[model samples]
Target: MTSTATSVIPSTSEWTPGDVEQAKEAREKLDIWPLDEYNCKLLNEVHPRNYVTNADEKEGSLVYDLIAIGAGAGGLVSSKQSARRGAKSAMITERLAGGDCLNVGCVPSKALIRSARAVSQVRRAAEFGVIVSGEVKVDFEAVMARLRRLRATIAPADGHPGTEEAGTHVYQGRGRLTGPNTVEVNGKTLKFKKCVLAMGGRPNIPSSIEGLMDAPFTTNENLFNLQVLPPRMVILGAGVVALEMAQSFALLGSQVTVVNRSSKLFESKQGDDEAAIILQNQLEKDGVTFLSSSTVQKVETINPGDGDKKLPLMKVTISDKVLECECLLVAAGRAANVENCGLEAANVDYELGKGVKVNDYAQSVSNPSVYAVGDCCAGVPRLTHMSGEMAKLVVQNSLANDQWKLSSLVVPAVAYTEPEYATVGIASEEQAKKQGVECDVYKASLEHNDRAILESSNIGFVKILVKKDTDEILGATIVAERAGEMINEVSLAMKNNLGLYAIGRNIHSYPTTGEAVMGCGVQYINKHLPRLD
Candidate 1:
């Protein structure tokens, strides 16, 4: 998307010499790794070293209608949504406004994954009766550069300029709750009628692993800064990030190995083991390796000297296996960014790993005036869209008397692997059974799909769970090239409380991947409905 960075620049009369000096200091203090041109440009658009706070520009004490403590997906949306409702909203962030998704998680990773997919497609061109090709190569530097470029290009929408343009006061500094209705940021005591805690989460590194802190390792936060692709790479954890990166790097020509603590993949509480195994199998065919039911015992840096140069390689010991790699990526999990935020002072309750405790209304259990959203909120799905949805709920519940419940929302998640794995609602038969709901699973294999067969891309299936003896949809899991897109229909069906029969009645176009979704519906109709064929 195009940025409005130029259009939102503050005029000369609005800023004094003191503000300019503070902006200069802010730029110098900002510590974005590899502070290259692209990153610097991104910083300028989001946090903006020259940004002058709205509080400083206006005279007298100002009390905001809403103050959001982060500028991530949740915070950005919360502040913007509140402002759109004609509330005097203010947002405070210690780092970039767009938070993890824009800077590190989704945007950059997808760019790299798309590039890797292109490489895989080219290598498999002969399968489509296309030959006569030289060595298919990958320029790792160019790939990373493109990723950074894309992030910078899209940063404005979630940055200082775009937020300010949307009528939300953007403050670039750490924000801490000092009281029930006040937050302190950069020596400014900002009072608010209500607050949104959206600091989000960060990549969790296992502290139990010996020598991990001192070892040569990287997280998603800094993984995109690499200019050179390591010849050998090892990843910790088996979640979406770990598996996705493992496959992407493998396709990019790196010898990639993934170490997982559990025997099964996608072992998270909301994970689907069947779908994960399908994706894992495809990753294996692409040259990625997996060491399951394992844990990293120790991590150390060992330099195997070559002449005058001393190149350090990471030595990792997992169970009985020992592996050495030029790079070690830690995708263990996410920990809430709750430290130093003064939750206690704000009468807010929070856990260490899980985030700010909130009720079904997304309001703090301890302080009703304060609400939390995104990864920072405990017991909520840590997805970008989920966060935005929660932010909207927070905006409505806080400002109006709306009783929007978080539990009522149906969430869908996707793991962006080659044959993408997407899941929603109840997840599995066991989960449905435990919830005391009997379910009948309707599955349609892509092998039988006409479009899948024509493209030779038939590797996975679409499986949906419906209430036993009824068409009431409970959940779904899809593993296909476009599973991410296909799962949306199931999510919509469940959200609207529509039965499987409704999907069966709808006409799907001939020869399409989405036919898999319709096929599941067709199965349910054929089993229950009277013969009309």
Candidate 2:
């Protein structure tokens, strides 16, 4: 069978900055991505080959030096590296041309958050002596349209290199391991010297709720794809995505009600419990409703055809009372996408929930010839960027090349909310104490930072944990503006074997969240001084 697919043009090459700005103005009037015809052309250019069809049954058995499954962050990086190293390779995936980060994960959500942040700025504009005339209304449809256009615009970078994309041969289908060192794609047998499994994962929906299946619910994967914003909404989890999404949809004009199974809003008592409480209190004042220590008994849809139109009339029963809303978003958790992948056929070792078993090199235990990376492989932390890094180590070891030191990697985790939280290493003091490590913590609140005060958004803190007798940095946490970018210093320190004192000596720019790291550095360093007699 021939693969006939539509191609997408990159918006950056065709739509210049001037064009983008003009399109924004045109959007005010047209309420769409400039013009429909032009947008379609742009989409086709970027995604030149449509990823709609599954692999056809090709009778030929193609053997390769390396094979990669999945085309997300991990798979793409591994495929590119392996090809560069002279390993004849192939990469397979079953999603849109653009992976989760582009289509449904980070990119789209962040674009939507940009609009949310702008709305938040207007709400707080009174503090800046900027008076508004009428209540700042939200054009939900227009906002969503902008996000879609941006996705269509940015998608080509990941999808197309105008053919001959400089990587492994790409396949459009799900891959299943039919034997050791072999996988089946599109009914074709593929033999490999070695293979890497980067199958990634999916969002989880709580099962305890009896009628939830019948209820209208959306996960992170499908939330941003909604055509209309709900008038009232309920979220079932208190994790990072739930909190960030709650703030986002709330800023974008949704009456958000959060029901968390845990008692605390974020359960963020890792360093300064006071700051977490402050944020929870502030969130309450901003009109976001919250309920803690509650479990969903069941999910019940009010009407069958309620969502016949884009906007739906929906209701859920929580707390023994029917919680009426237009939609329900489940940010409960994530599950590894390992089903029907033929892991059982190859006797690949895996846990039902934790994912495929792997070692420092991201190698699978069941088959020595196979390895795994990203969300599909177990790690101390699971993040897209980290997955890309892990893939590099696996690829290097697979190619027998010398590069990344698998043991010396220091990874950081960031939660992208208005007041972000970034962390690396250990934070659970209780866990540390039980581990028999002598630890002390130093903290600096954002309220004291000049930059945070200047921005009028001082709402976080930074904490440093070190071994009591030594200056070695054990772990650190930052809950502040741009904590995602600010957490790098701590991560570097951990990776390079540097202490908090060295981080304190390094000068940082003024009026920035990064300065908080410097402040934390000084605090931790000062604690190491010789005691007075």
Candidate 3:
């Protein structure tokens, strides 16, 4: 490993008592750690002189040029790119080897979702012209075990920290800033020329809800860990987290009740008004209850009847009514991991909830040398895939002869509910006013789509926004089965500056949800009379 120090600063060059004192003095002056009061303790015992000394007897440590705190999607991409771009870097995080995705987030959640979906399909196999089974049963524990094993198998490729390069290092510890350009990891001080805070965020459960803290509740991180499915579950949010898990659990055989402080579950998507009614109506038919516009006042846990292994039941009081559930899954929201990073002292400019502010380049507003991304540093959407792109922007802007910027790309956010919600680009009305860009919106109901008719996913639609004067596409939203896949075409249109005319001319496959894209384009073409015509 090649260790290089900054040329802007002078090194003592020798390991005499005076040099040791000088090193300690410099660390204290920079507030970089190994302070004078603890210098002897760290040098003689904690770190040890031989531990840091070189083969030629030069007492030195690897001073990385860049340090990335967190090994999640954002951190790994940033570190790898930084190393490849010829910068000395290191990544630090506090988890069981992998970050949330491989250990708990995407890997476990999606695996369980797919497993639940399998059970759901099998239960309805008789509808598909197959009649067999003495009552459909679920061996949820075995399913969970399989999910855990699969997560372990896939950890190395997606979760393993650090790259194979010589200059980059990965360590397992919670990194905290002790100086503007310095970080201390479990007492080991790592100094770097630049820093990137990719540590992401944690679930934000409100404190005003009284006994929620003392109660045995589950977050997205712990919800999928349950080997035995709960008999009843009360989810407390209307956001993506709450909605996704609510659908997953309900399908997995749990009696689910979604209590949102709003009347509708998904109000963000345009035309979701009708779809929300349809979803609630369908889920209610399948034993899912909706306690809309309700607030979870408090919760108290009672012993479970199953056994010691089974989790205790939670009794939640919403408004003036009392409701009981075998488990309470809290997916309220998420907060940035920015508390102890010394942003105020570092003069890092940030918004109330957006995190370390960045323009198109993903550079920190407070310090151009520093950058942030991921859940903590939200870009267009706070998705793992989007954060990976943001980290790429940081890497490109920081080094090499690259001129690409990430803001130019289109990002899509997917809420993995039963009928997944996926959207991209500007809202029709908002775009019209925001840029004074005249636009016409064309919406095609899935009720008319042959694919939707076959799949029973006719409750959604594909909405398109086009520039009224020029027919240039502005945005699109799809709320249907495989909406995540369908939203990409709209994103591609916005990315390539494609117009409604081009989309209308493009032939879409029949008996598919994406045909709605061409349908919308045709509708837009029909709405306006061409000047040539």
Q: List, in order, the clash count of every candidate structure.
A: 0, 15, 2
What overall lDDT, based on C-alpha atoms, would model 1 receive against the true structure? 0.84
Question: Largest TM-score belongs to which candidate?
Answer: 1
For each candidate, the alpha-carbon lDDT, in order, equals 0.84, 0.71, 0.68
Locate the minimum summed-lDDT window of 10 residues in model 2: 1-10
RMSD of each: 4.8, 6.5, 10.2
Per-residue accuracy of model 2 over 36-106 as CA lDDT, tens digit each: 44344433443332333221224442566778888777887777677777666677766544456766788
Which pairs of residues have clashing backbones in candidate 1?
A: none
Error of 1 at 122 (Å): 0.4
Candidate 2 Cα errors over 4 Å, as ranges: 1-61, 160-164, 266-272, 304-309, 401-407, 529-533
What TM-score against the true fold does each predicted structure earn?
A: 0.92, 0.87, 0.82
Model 1, 89-145: lDDT tens digits are: 889998877889998889999999999999998998999999947999999878987
State the RMSD for candidate 3. Answer: 10.2
TM-score of 2: 0.87
What is the per-residue lDDT of model 3 for residues 109-134, given as tens digits with 9 covering 90 to 100?
Answer: 87877876776677778776878768
Pairs with backbone N, CA or C atoms under 3 Å apart (clashes), candidate 3: 438-468, 439-468
**Better by lDDT, candidate 3 or 1:** 1
- Candidate 1 ranges beyond 4 A from true positions: 1-33, 56-61, 303-312, 531-533
Ten contiguous residues with the weakest lDDT in model 3: 46-55
Best by lDDT: 1
